[model samples]
Each structure stands twice: as C-alpha cells, then as structure tokens.
Target: MGGSRHVATSSTHPGDLHIPGSHRFYCTAPCLSWRGGVGMRGSVPPPLIPVSPSSLLQPEPLLLAPSGTSRPAGSHRALRGSLERESFKPSSQPEEPKHNRRQPSPCPRSVVEAAKAHPTFGELFQFATPVLMWDQHFSPETWNRLKERHVPYGWQGLSHAAVSSTLRLLNASANRHLFDRRRFPGGCVRCAVVGNGGILNGSRQGEAIDAHDLVFRLNGAVIRGFEEDVGTKISFYGFTVNTMKNSLIAYEEYGFTQIPQAEDLKYIFIPSDVRDYIMLRSAIQGSPVPEGSDKGDEPRKYFGPEASAEKFKLLHPDFLHYLTARFLRSELLNMQYGHLYMPSTGALMLLTALHTCDQVSAYGFITANYEQFSDHYYEVEKKPLVFYANHDMLLEAELWRSLHQAGIMELYQRFQLENALHSAITPQPKRLAPGQDKWEESLAWRRNGLN
Candidate 1:
C-alpha cells in the first residue's frame, strides 16, 4: 500500500497511483459529496448505485423460468469472455501437443439437440437404490481417498506455471472466436468469479475487482447496493434456473432484479431441470411459443438468435470428476452438501472455467468471517445463511476458506487498522419467516405427493 506514487486530489484524499514494479495501477475517484468510510453496521446497505438511469427501478428482470420470462442476455459475460478467450486464435507457434491427441470433431447438431432434450436432472443424478451408471462409475476407494486420485490427473504437486499453461490451452481453443484479438497479445486469458458473500459488503474493492478479463456472479447478486464495494460491471451470471428465479423472488425487496444485462453479456445456463433445458434451447433458437400457453405470451426477449448451439459450451463431465478429486474432498464436500457426490452447481461452473482459463480469481465467495455476515454481500436486508433442503452453504463456506488458504484462489477482504465506521449488523428474525416452517411443510407435501 505504501509503495505507490500517490495521485492526491485534495489534502485529505488521494486520486490515483502507480505501484512500483507492478503492472497494476490504482485509482481513487473522489467526490466532495462522497462520505468516505461508511461502516457495515445497523443500517442496511443500499443497492448498487444505478450505472445508467435507464436501468433503475424497472420491474424485476424476468428470466425464462419456464413458467415465467427468461433472464436477458449479458448475464454471463464473464463466462462468455472466458469462452471467447478459449476460442481465441491458437498460439502462432504451437507447442508440443499435450500427449498425442487429434482435434475433436465439432459436436453434431443431433447430439447437441439430443442433449438439449435430455432430462437434465437425470443426466446429472440418479437415486442410489440400484446406483446409476454415472454414480457407480467411480470406485468407493477413490471416493475414500481424494488425495490419491489427485495424483493421476496433472494435479499432483502441480506448480502454478504448469496449471496456468494447461488452462491457457483450454481457453485458446474454447473461446477463439469471441475475441477479435487477445488482450495480452501472447498472454494467457484470465477470469475472475465473484461470489456475493457478505464479506464483500464493506470491502473497498470496486476498481481492483474489475481488472479481470471476465467476472462471474451467482444467486442474490445485488450489484446496485454494493456497487461501491463490488464494482458496477458484471461479466457473467451463473445459476440453475430455479436458483436464479428463487433469488429474484426471495430478494426482490432488496432490488435483486435479474442479474445485470450488457450488450455483450452471455447468459450461461447451468441446467438443473427439464424446463430449464427446454427454455434455454428455445432462447437460443428464438422460437416463439403460443401466447395463450401457461408459459408467457410474448416472444422470449432476453436472448436473440445470436446464441446458437455452436456458441454454447457445456461443462465436461470429466472436469467435474477432476474437481471433486482434487480440491473438494469428503470433509468439505460432505459437510457443505450432504452425500459425498457431484459438484455444487456454482463450484462446477467456476471450476470448469478454472480448468479452461489461464488465470482465475474468486470474489464475494466465502471468507473467514462469513458467519459474522449475511448470506450475500448485496443482501438488501441482513439474512443469515439458512440451511435449506436445497444445498449445504456452510460446508461450501468451509471449502472456499480452505481453497483460499491453499493459495489456489483469492477472496476479497477489507483492512481497517483502526475503528471502522460500521460493523456487520446481524439480522433479526421476522415473524413467521418463510424458511422457518417450510421443512416440515415440505415433508407433509412430499408424503402427499403434492410437490
């Protein structure tokens, strides 16, 4: 912090600075009206300041929730950017191919269409009564010893340079078409996935946070309220259709409109259900559904026909196996989500990009003091991370912490040597909170088959 040449605006403020021996430059935009050092205490944080007046206070952005509107494009710019980077021009001087491998043929429309129509849930999971093929493919011994499995993949005692190089190759091929030219000329593409954990609430990382070629966000990503802290730009928004819809429904009062939209933003679908798969395909093809149907009447407007099968990239199943074997083991995976199997949706998406990008950074993810903050950094109202039937958030927090400590990624944190203006204010329970009685009701509903 002290090594940079400070660009001072006023006697009390600094404008910009160049760090010695570093490519990174820091800037400080100061306004006379700006009240610096607002603490994260009793008062609720405001939604992100609107980047453009046109984007302010519109109806919650509707997404194609099957029964509802589809989320607009530019939701997953970061992922698209990374994908574009992946599809970039192959290096001018091709290095020795990794092992001996032929270029894979372009996936056929029939295969792509079949996958589009496939039952997403069944494709990803199955009940263990007889144990599905995908579930049984892994040996229990391999499950019992994650570290041992890490050895066979290139991950055993992998160096940063080695990991970086492998990811670069993936990016160059996957995103070669998206970028007219590479950012670094010859440099590897970089991506940063920013979570919306409350740890970013008070952290002043706006400018520094946006330096990556791409940025990713997930559920409850309240940008307006946390703009000063998390920055105003969003490159990608990843979520299962249900999760995205749920967050918008759950956090509507806090200004959780559909994740921000940009002209170049690409919505990356994490297929979780049959409806999501159908809707995403419809969105890409620009097919108009009957207006009087239960779905919506209007032609879906969130995405244009520009999104075609060729441009979409699905996560490779092997990549998910690789992540589970290396970083997320029994202790963390089981603790976070029950059943020591499969990657969490967000984890799967992030790790997919990590395996494909040259460099990766994580933001708003679980930080050390997570329990002391709300579930999301952009929470309109402070709400603790509740354990729902859906997923194990706490265990995920632990995994994120472990990954951060291992230096495999970065987490946003604020430094305040003295008394901070505000502290994290805990949320008080509301009467008959939605989550409080849902589990028991859910059990009854399931027994009656009403769900």
Candidate 2:
C-alpha cells in the first residue's frame, strides 16, 4: 500500500521524478527525487542526497524552462546570476605579443653633409653675433620686432595672445619635410619660380621648367590647357589668404576652379592677416574655421579633403621682415598706402627659392618690358598690365635685372624682343598736374574691387 501511494504521488507530480523511456520534465522549484536526492527535475540518474548544513547553504542549481513555456520569477534571478558569473570569469585566451615598429627613413647623408658644408644665408644670419632667424617658427622677441617693423594691412590690430596662439597651433602640427635630403639627394636642389606674368605666354620653357628639382608657383597659375607653356609640374604653391581667396573669386572663369592638389605638392601660406592663422589652424585640425571674419569657412573647400598639417607651411613674420629689410623694400613704405605695400607673391616665392635652393631660375616675372605683354599669361586678350600702389613693380624689375647681372639667379630675359616690343608700343607719358601721378585713381579703383 505504501509503494502504491509513492507511485501515485510521482504520477501526480511528474516533474519530481524521471519517468523511464520518455522525455524528461524540468522543475522550477527543488524537488525530491525517487532516490531521496534534492535537485532540479530530469538532470540525470538519481544521486545520494546531502544532509550537512554546508550542503544546504550551497547555491541552487539554475532552472531552465522548456520551450514554449514561461520561466518562474526565481528563474530570472538565476539567469542573471549565471550571466554575472560568466562575465566575471577569467578569459583563457592569450593576448597578442607586441613587436617593435619600424621608424621613418632619415634624410640622405650627402644632403645633410652638403647643408653643413654650404651654410645658407639663413644659417649665416642665425649664427651672426646679433642673430636674425628666418625659419617659420618665431620667438616672442622676434614677434614683437615683426609687429613693430612689419604691418599686415588687412588684419585687425596685432595682439601678443593671438600671435602666440597661432604659433603654438602651428608648432603642434605635424612636421614637414622641409628641403628633404631624400628628395634632393644630389645636394644641389634646382628650383624654378614661375610667376603669372605674360612673359611666359610664348616662352616655350615648359621642359626647362619641369627639369628643376622643385617649382614654386604663385597666383592664378592656370596650367590645364596651357601645360605646354607653363609645365605640368608644381612643387610648392605660395599665396596669402587674401590673394588665394581673391584669385578663386576673380579667376574662376580662367580654369582656376581649384588650387593645385597634387600628391607631392605643398602649400606655403603667406601670413597676411589673422585670418590666415585662423584658417591654417582650422585646416590642420580638419574643422570649420572658428570665430573670425572667416567664421564657418571650410578650408577643405579650398585646400582639398586630404590637406594635412605637413602639407601646409607658414612663412614667419620675422622672415618676411628680414626679406623686406634685406631684398625687396619699396619706397611706398613712406606713403599713406605703406601698410598695404608688400612684395608681390611672385617676388616672395622667388626670394624664398633663392634662399633655399642651390640654383633658382625665375620665369614669367615682371621685366622692364612688362608693358609689351598682357597682365597674365592665361589672358585671352592682350590687356595692358595695370600698376597699383600696393606693389612696386619698377623696384622689383630693377632688382631682378640686378640679381641677374650679379649671377645670383638666372632670370629669364628676352631683351631683344622686349626692347623691340617696347619701342613699338611705347606711349608718350600723359602729363598729370603737379604731385598727381594717378596714384589716387589707382587706389580708388582698387578700393572699388577693380584690381
């Protein structure tokens, strides 16, 4: 009767017992097995039961619900506990072994030796007793000197904080391959400074221009359809922020929809205003131009998406001051438009190349016979070149001629053609009233955006 009663109870609660030759039933609560063991239903053959206090304190076995059935409230807590245990468990897999990474290739030994052997003007200046450094980095003393001596016209008043921030940001940018020895392995870097002057219109000097180790081009350098005359190679492009923006605005019709973006090409930023520093910082950071007259301006729109810190070079204000004090100072310094006067982009590039390269050849630059040709080589019509108070063309022309005579640089000269053309087109000087030489008219025209 007792055995029959146990069988009846097991039959009533099938989950408490494992029925032979049938699928097992799982239990939500602890159940007594047929052999007096305590465990979840359908685990395995019945085992011996534990009666110690330690056994009672042990955690309960996790309960899993059958398919299509709901789990009990305690089952949820068990699931969470199981997951926590799994998360805290140590991983058995080993970590990857780290290896030493290779460094970038250094500059060629020969070029380094050559740089040491032939001290450049910049190096000599730096070594002088009263030293004057000429690199892009500026000290506070140098910045103060530049502020006093050099005035960038379009900028707001100069401030130490602003200038310091610009320098700090620039210094934080990736280092450039400045005159890389690997690129100039022969230790004699020849450079071509190509200006946009119309002298290059029929010069047929493309092959000669491309042969140089580096080529510096500035302003409206339209070379797509006119590659035969201007050459396809451009190593460095130099421009002020004002000039670059103006060039894009003014010369979009002449195939200059974008600036040069060759993989190996670099940009030299002429710091003509605080906007330049702002733009440069934004460009390096790959962000929109922050707080300034050029707020919300996208630098990638001008310098392309791949533009990087290493690809942009800023000219130090002190360097500009040194260049002005040494080579390209104009008499306009004393005039009312003195603040507006600076060397043209071409003059700056040519002088920079002269100081950096072993040999430099200038092309399409203003000559004494500039009146014979159009204002720009890409001009479809032979428009007469207009003179402005901002640049001293006459002074630049004399300097070029003198530099050529001294053999410091090879300035492309077509004297016979220039002389003949000048003689044929020379006009009688229009007599102006005393102390009136069309300066005011030019200034007014420039102010009205006619330049």
Candidate 3:
C-alpha cells in the first residue's frame, strides 16, 4: 500500500519544515541500481511561464483516468503522475531559493576538461554542460515532433502543460549544474560514484570512497552495516521514482528501509518519464503526488519534512539523449527489442560525475569479470548479475574500460577474487570524511506512510 499523508490541521509545528496536511513545504532526494525498468528520455528545452495553472495538460488535452479503475489491461493513463502539472504551492515568504550546493573541503585546482573529444562523437564529453530543463527548452516544434514519438529518450507521450509545469518549478530554485563551482577551493573537485555491484563487498574501500569531496550513490544503497566498505557520506543520489519505490519494496530486508537524507545531500531526478517529473514536483512541493503512476505518494516520507527547492535537480533529457548516442551506444538498440534500452542508472550517475567533477572514481560498478562476484555488494547471498533487456551491461563495461584506460576516471576493478577479499581482512587507516557532520543520520526511518 502507498503511504498516506499525515498531519494536524493546526500548523503550529514550531521547527518542522511543514505539517503534511498543513499548507507548508520543503524538499529532498534518493535512487536505486538494480536491473529493472528504467525509463531514460529528455531534452534541453528552456523554462517558460507554465502554460496555465488550471491545465498542466493544456495546449494538448488528453484523456484522464485513475489507474486503479477497471480500465483495460494496457490503456495508458492520461493523467500521468508528473504530467498532472500543478503550480507550486506559494511559499509564505516567496523568497528566491538558495540551493544547498555541496562545497567539499578546499583542495587543489582540479576540474575535468578533457583536452580532446573522444573519437565516438568528436566531442569532449561535455563536462560542464547544463543538466536541468526549463521553460525555454519546451519549444512547440520539438513538442510537435517528439512528444509522442518515443525516440531517443524521455519526454514522449506527454502533454505541453504537464512538461511545462514541471520544468517551471525546476527553474524555481534548482541550478542547471550539479554543484556550485565557487564552493570548491581551486575550482577543482574530486568525486566518487558508488554502485551496488559486489566488487566492494569486502574490498574495504570505505576510506578511499569517503575521502572524495563529494560522493554519488544509487540503487539499493544499503549503508548501515557496510559503512566500513561503502562509507557514510552521500552528497548526491540519482534515481527515477520507479526504481526508488521498487528498491524499497524489493530490498527492505537488506536494511535499506530509507533513502539517505542529510542537509548537504541533493537529489538528481532522471526524467525517464513524466512520472519522474510528477514525483520531483511533489517532492519540491512537500505534498502527495497529485496524479499519475504514483498518485498519493507522499514525497515527505522519503525525503523528510525539510525538502527544499535547492535540494533537488532534474537531469536534462538532452544529457541522456547525448549520453546514449555518443558514449554508451550499444548494438542492443539495433536488435528488435533495442528501443527499450538506455544507459543504466549507475551509468547515468557515473557519467554525470565524470562530466561535473574534476576527478571521478567509480566503486562497485560492473567490471569485465562480474560473474566472479555476487550481483550486488550488499546482497545477503551470492546471486549472479541479472542482464535485463533494458540495458546492455557489456557495452557500459567497455565504455568504463576505455574511459579508465584513457585516464579519464578510476574504475575499482581487479581480476583476482583473492585480492578483493584481502581488502576486508587487511588493516587500513580509519578517517572521517570531510564535512561528514553535515550528513548526520536522518530520523525519517521512524515515520510512516512512505510510498
């Protein structure tokens, strides 16, 4: 069952960011890495005034029906969760949003600027490109051609209002990039992108991972008992609503009862579908998912009451569109079932880090010898990695291999199982991550009605 909103009609919670049923608001983030249906499609449209507060589906009216009704087996829901675009709740102060951009401890100048473009597209992986979509990106021509076409990536089968309302709020407080450059010491930042692959099960790479200025983690990120292996600091989390919920339901026993929440953490919403927009909006608004695949979902449950506009970011569809086309292109797309493919969530997060951070280190991602380890580092029992059709793990592995060899990023890979197991038994220095105090454990795990 989906979590229901809880609050008192009286809005007198002195320090609380909001009272769910009350007219208050806040913002937050999370993501998952398991092989499941991950929708990845979007564009680099600019932000504009939302079409109309009354119709998130304006300019293009579509049918609306509750998914819970006696609808046909496969009839698509007109009122998608994200597409049910509603204007953001007016904040009492209505002040300009100040995002919680992570400023890691000052370090030497370190920014990623590849000297030459990879031969793949004759373009250096656009490291510092804009990532979030806004009003201007939603041009009429692009919508006319791609709204329902389902081509390169997301933004298909959605109405103008739905997309517009969502983008409008994104520009409300979020920045187009992952972090603020000025926050770093020398305009250089180091980051670690952590995946759940079993390579880190006992690798004891925690000290190395927590050493970076910022860290990105995703998909079944079970951190409690394995802090010695995965570290306790999480600067960013990337995931679609589908994966977040599915991970919660599927991995609850693994101890991932809640997504990591802290003052410094930010969420990167991959607009894989309109549903992502809906969840992102609700998360920003601190209310229930107004409509769509996740109707009645309480963003407050997963994010906590302090959900702020500055805490969230929506991945520009253009980024994904460019990524799949240039870097992670796979032959799977050529097969009859190829259209279902896009980069995995881990790939998206890793690449995002590669583009945004000066130095990138990947931990627990799939390596060439994936069969030697269990599916995920946090798994209770050994299970082979599942190759779902939606992603081509081999292609991603090769891309990482090439990039690692090219001196672009560090991929935590080793050919021998004995060496990996040695990491756990070996003695290593214990150290605290810089600014770890900002990411103290959240108390939301005790709350209820989490969808």
Tell me, by TM-score, which candidate is best. 3
- Clashes, model 3: 29
For model 2, state the Cα shift of residue 120 in Å. Answer: 17
User: What TM-score, computed on C-alpha atoms, does each candidate reach?
Assistant: 0.49, 0.62, 0.67
Q: What order do candidates take by TM-score, descending?
A: 3, 2, 1
Cα lDDT tens digits, model 3, 48-130, are: 11110011111111222221223233211221222322222211111112442333424343323331333321233443345
Report the C-alpha lDDT of model 2 over 1-451, residue by residue, as the tens digit.
Answer: 1121111112222223333332322221122223233332323322111110000000111111222332222322132222211111111111111431212223232222332343222122211111112224457545644554334421236676656665565542234233565555555677899998887888788899999889999867889877878898999999876567656655667888888888888888877767677888788777898877668989998788888767777765545655554444444443333444567788888877765656678999887667667778888887666454345665577566555544557888654454555665777222222332222222222223211
User: Model 2 off-target regions past 4 Å?
Assistant: 1-150, 153-156, 172-177, 415-451
> Which regions in candidate 3 have their CA more than 4 angstroms from the true location?
1-111, 114-124, 139-152, 417-451
- What RMSD value applies to candidate 2? 36.3
- Local distance difference test, per candidate? 0.39, 0.55, 0.59
In Å, residue 105's CA in model 3 sits off its true spot by 16
How many clashing residue pairs appear in each of the predictions shown? 34, 0, 29
